[model samples]
Target: MADKGPVAMIDPSQLMRPEPTFNDKPLQAYRDYTIDDTDPIKERVRRTYYEMHSKMTVDLFKEKREKWLKFNHFKATVKDALIRLNEVVDESDPDLDLPNIVHAFQTAERIRHDHPDDDWFHLTGLIHDLGKVMALYGEPQWCVVGDTFALGCKWADAIVYGPESFKNNPDTYNPKYKQVSICTKKKNFVTTTLYGMYKPHCGLDNLLISWSHDEYLYQFLKHNKSTIPEEGLVMIRYHSFYPWHSGGEYRHLTNEKDVETLKHVTEFNKYDLYTKSEKIPDIEALWPYYEKLIEKYIPGVCEW
Candidate 1:
């Protein structure tokens, strides 16, 4: 991991932009995964993705799902889990260098600004990354953060570092894991094709996505019986799926339900990504409002 060095200071003028910008940088400037060993942030981002793409196999995905999905790790209120994020800085994120808590407030505040009546949307932004508490509890950021893609399928072209990053991944060459189709003559046998183990239009819900905080938090919310609307839960679940949402990959496997999911996730993404360089919110002052949300939607001490 590269040294984070000093936290970059935000320009006051950039704070009040009517549109999203990476501080003084353009929107295109963020999410830069360019490999450059000389650039610490770029190197950090590159290495994280390379490691993720290389090691996130179908088996490991299952193992991680089994490990985290039980929700037996520890117990805490939603607010407490979020506060733990103050200790986490996402290694996979190139844009934001501050603590995850800052980003949480930034996202929620921005959503609140735009959709004042949608309190659930505001709460969704705040807790979207709360699953990142997995980092504090011993999970690597490689698995807990970053863009997620479908496992047991051909790697999509839109993944951060491209297929080259997955050269060492065993699943990359595993015939069973690569894209395949059912054999016409033999129902039990299959032939290699472009949609892997999934049928056409299977919908995103059925796909086994690589393990990440997105899925973890989504499942965690479900396990604890959160009252957030289905759209908000979908936003939390697939917001990290940049390959599908941002890169326009995997349409062959997606269905009408995923089309609706895409709308919610894409809308949630604007606040999640572009707010990175926005003015930092006064977290201490803002907690009361968000705590009320936590109580209403997913309150009290809950299992991790």
Candidate 2:
């Protein structure tokens, strides 16, 4: 893990809240990825996605998994890791510009409100993005935040910015990762079209998804032996996978398990996305409740 500079603390009381339906903005108003060079924030979001699409390749995904999965980076309790998010501002997000910690509490509180009986679900929402802590160390935000896609396959048409953003990526041209198909005529003439390396209906777990905080924290929880339920874990792992869950792509690569996983991820997505701009939760007042959750499911200092 790399050294981190001082992170300024945010006072929940000082934060401004959004007003109405899905944080005052219309439901469709969120996730506006319109390309406008004149708009600084839009440009930042575009640049971040283009860079992520161009740089996150199958090989790089493998390398990142090997590196971070080692769990040798650093140690912190779940609460401490959540606090580290105070320094993270997701460049890929066009919505909410607040620190990631604010979003974490926002998501968790929303989940708790709706699913009062599911403490695990509340905790899952709180810690889903804890993997973004990699940003505080040495990882770049491009790979740490944003929607993730499978690398060893055809880029889903629904992926943010579509396939056009991946034109500069070497893996886009790599035959092994490119999706292809072939047809044969009576004379033995063959027509070929690119498909990817994975077989049809190979479970989502079998595919190599682009590296992001979602996958990192999913693996992290497993490594630390956290008792978050399978549904909660699936929610954490694939919530950022908007292409499959939200865009309705990749059915060819998913199996029965993914069918169930989709339900959980979709249920969890409401709190994650819609709650981002809601009134900031009183973090200081709320910590005790979540601390109890952390202690119950994932107590003590954990390996990063």
Candidate 3:
């Protein structure tokens, strides 16, 4: 990853305006899950999480880690792996219905447009969702996509679908787990504020996040000893951990390192989530730049 210091002079005027919130785009129907009952896309998203929440137990996560952490499932270059991921559509996304590759390119391009000097940041956006290839490899969407939360602990009320989504989850019946601290549904409590004001230091490593593509790619990068910096890796790993990054859950599990990582993850989340719109990237034109990026940071065929 590039240094935190500015790599090149950035013209504040040229930076693209922040992506509009869903509430700001009232004219066009965008991913408004509040109306999931009437919106088929949102309904599908809900159903996807229904399965994810119900089945993703600590034991299941451990079982999956045992299988995938070996990094022996397959081997392919970064581009090849991403193209393979193109076949997998995220069932949990209420936004666009494009190929995953398109989403990957969109994210990277948006980051490039905004932060041109930091090629590492651009690469982070490009490869962030490459782990979704698990879905193409026969993993169900329930296990591969959606918001991830910690297992072996109390479920947070602020998670997207709320505790109702975990009704059938085996972990819900466990009595040993209890809520440590929860950021209330306060209006001004954003991700950073949630971490600063309501932050807890229970230790990130001790917490068990729900098995998803985020964890898979994170472990893959670590096992192979890829050079992507810790912040970049955190962006890859926790971009979908909305319950922590967006919902303010699991603040109790974060240590000081997580507090610092949270800033980068929060910044990366804007490009990751808000870039999915009608505009698609010219993959042929963009490929050369990102291909070179892959070579620089995560080159050659890597274990999957």
Q: Please provide, for model 3 over 1-304, each residue's C-alpha lDDT reduced to its tens digit, 9 standing for 90 to 100.
A: 8645312211121132234542234323333454335567667887898888889887899999898888788888988998886688788887778889898988898889889999999999999998888887778999998778777777776566677778898767654443233334665443222222222576766677889999999988887778888889989988877767766667666888888888888899878877787677899898899989999898888988
| Separate clash counts for every candidate | 0, 9, 0
User: What lDDT tens digits, residue by residue, belong to model 1 across residues 206-228?
Assistant: 99999999999999999999999
The weakest ten consecutive residues by lDDT in model 2 span 9-18
Q: In terms of TM-score, which candidate is stronger, 1 or 3?
A: 1
* lDDT over C-alpha atoms for residue 27 of model 2: 65
Q: What is the lDDT of every predicted structure here?
A: 0.84, 0.83, 0.76
Residue 255 Cα positional deviation in candidate 1, in Å, after optimal superposition = 0.5
Clashing residue pairs in candidate 3, if any?
none
TM-score, every prediction: 0.89, 0.89, 0.83
The lDDT leader among the candidates is 1
Q: Please say which candidate is ahead in lDDT: 1 or 3.
A: 1
